[model samples]
Target: MSGRFDRRVMVVTGAAQGIGRRVAELAAAEGARLVLVDIADYVQGVAADLRDQGADVLALQADLEAWEGAESVMARAHERFGRIDILINNVGGTIWAQPYEHYTPAQIQKEIQRSLFPTLWCCRAVLPHMVDQQAGVIVNVSSVATRGLMRVPYGAAKGGVNALTVNLAYEYAGQGIRVNATAPGGTEAPPRLTPRNTEAQSEQAQAWYQRLIDQTNAHSFMHRYGTLDEQAAPILFLASDAASYLTGTVLPVAGGDLG
Candidate 1:
C-alpha cells in the first residue's frame, strides 16, 4: 500500500518504547526510512523488528538530554538518510509526581533537563540542516500536564516546549520548515520497560500519583485516557505533507483540555 511517507527520511527520538516506539512503528508502515534514537540500547531491537518487516531502519543509542547527543543524532541521521524530511522530538517525560514544595532543587533541575533541554537542543542542532535544504517538518511531543498538578517542574518544561514550538515555527517558516506540537493528555500504554523512577512510592506519593490520574480523567471532555495510536496519528499528521499549511499550531490530544 502506498503511504504518505514513502521514501521519506524521518528521525524519531526516544524510540525505545511507549509513544516514541509507536510513532516509529506507524511511520515505518507508511514507508518512512527511520532513524530510531534512544539512550536505551534496546532501541536496536526496535530497529531490528522494523527491518524484519521490510522497512529501512537505523537505531542509535544517544542521551538526548545532552547537546552533544542531539548534534550527533542529527549528524548521523543525515549521513545515513542523505536528507532529513521529518523530526519528531519525543524525548521528554515526567520522572516524578509530587507538589512543587515536595521537590528538591536538584529534582526540579532534573525535570527540566529531562523534559526541556532535549527538544531545545535538538531543534538547534537540526535547524542548520533543515535550513540548508530549505524544507523540513518538526513535531514536538508536549503534554497537557502543563496545567495539571503533581508535576509542576515537568509542566514548566512542557510549557517551555510550547513556547519553543510557536517561536521556532515563526523563525523558520520563511525557510520552509514547519514546526508544530501535540499536547497529549493521559495515554494508555504498556508498563514502562525502564521505569522513570525506581524509588518505591510511599503512601503519600502513591496518593499524589493517583490524584494526578483522577485529575486527568476529570479534566478530559471524553473522561478517559487515549490510546497510543490516537497520540501518534496527530503527530504523524503534523509531520506529513497533509499539514502543509499548518505551522506553529499545538494540537491538543487531551480530549477537551486546551493545554
Candidate 2:
C-alpha cells in the first residue's frame, strides 16, 4: 500500500492475540516496523511468524499493568527502531464482572488495572518521543460498552479511555500528535468472546451470562458478533496516515450496535 506510514516504527500492545494481533499484522503489511508488546507468553511466537514474513518485528513480554512495563517497551522500541512514529495503546480487556455489591475491593482494582491503567502508562511513556519528533499517532482501543449501559467496571474503564483520548487530543493537537479511540462491539472470537456460555459455574449465573450475550448481539443493527479483523480495521486505519486529520474521536465498529 502506498501510504505515509511506510517503514514507520509502530508499537502495538496486547498484541499476542485478538484485535491487537490483527492490528500488528496489518500494520506490518503496510510496511511499518513493529514492536509488539503483550504480557501473554505467546507474543514471541507471533513475532517470529511476522518476522518470517520479512517484516521488521520485535516481541516483548511485559505486563503493562506496571508502569515499568510501559517504560520498558518504549525504551526497547527506541533502542531497536531509533524512533516511534505510531503508538497503538491496544492493551486492556474485560477482566472481571459482577453486581456492584458483589465485587471485592481487590477485584475492582484488578479490573481497573487490566482495562485502563496500561493505556495511561503507555501514553505517558510515548508522549515525549512524539513531542520530540513533532509528529505521531496514538490509537487507544476502547469498547462499545462505554457508549451506554453494560458491565460496570469494563464500561467505566473504557469511558475513561474516551476521556483520555479527548484530553490528549486537545493537549497534543498543537504538538503534532493525534489521539483517538476505536470501540469495537463484542466479537465472537476467543479471548474476546467464546463458545462456552457456561464458564460461570452456577446454572443461574451461566444463564444470566448467556442472556447478556444474547442482548448484546441483538443490540447491533446486525444481529451478530464481529470478527477480530473487522474490529481491528478502524484501529489500524487510525494508526495510519489515512486518518491524519482525525483525532479526539471515538469510532464505533460495532456493526452499528450502540443501542
Pairs clashing in candidate 2? 220-257
Task: Assess each prediction's global lDDT (C-alpha) against the native.
Answer: 0.95, 0.83
How many angstroms is residue 175 displaced in model 2 relative to the true structure, after the best TM-score fit? 0.8
Query: Per-residue lDDT for 87-197 in model 2, tens only?
Result: 988877665444556667877777787889999999999988899999999999998876443357778888899999999999999999999999888786675332212
RMSD of each: 0.7, 2.6
- Which stretches in model 2 have alpha-carbon errors above 4 Å? 1-4, 147-150, 191-200
- Model 1 lDDT per residue over 144-177, tens place: 9989999999999999999999999999999999
Residue 91 CA displacement from its true place in model 1, Å: 0.8
TM-score of each: 0.99, 0.92
Candidate 1 regions exceeding 4 Å error are none
Poorest lDDT segment (10 consecutive residues) of candidate 1: 1-10
TM-score, structure 1 vs. true? 0.99
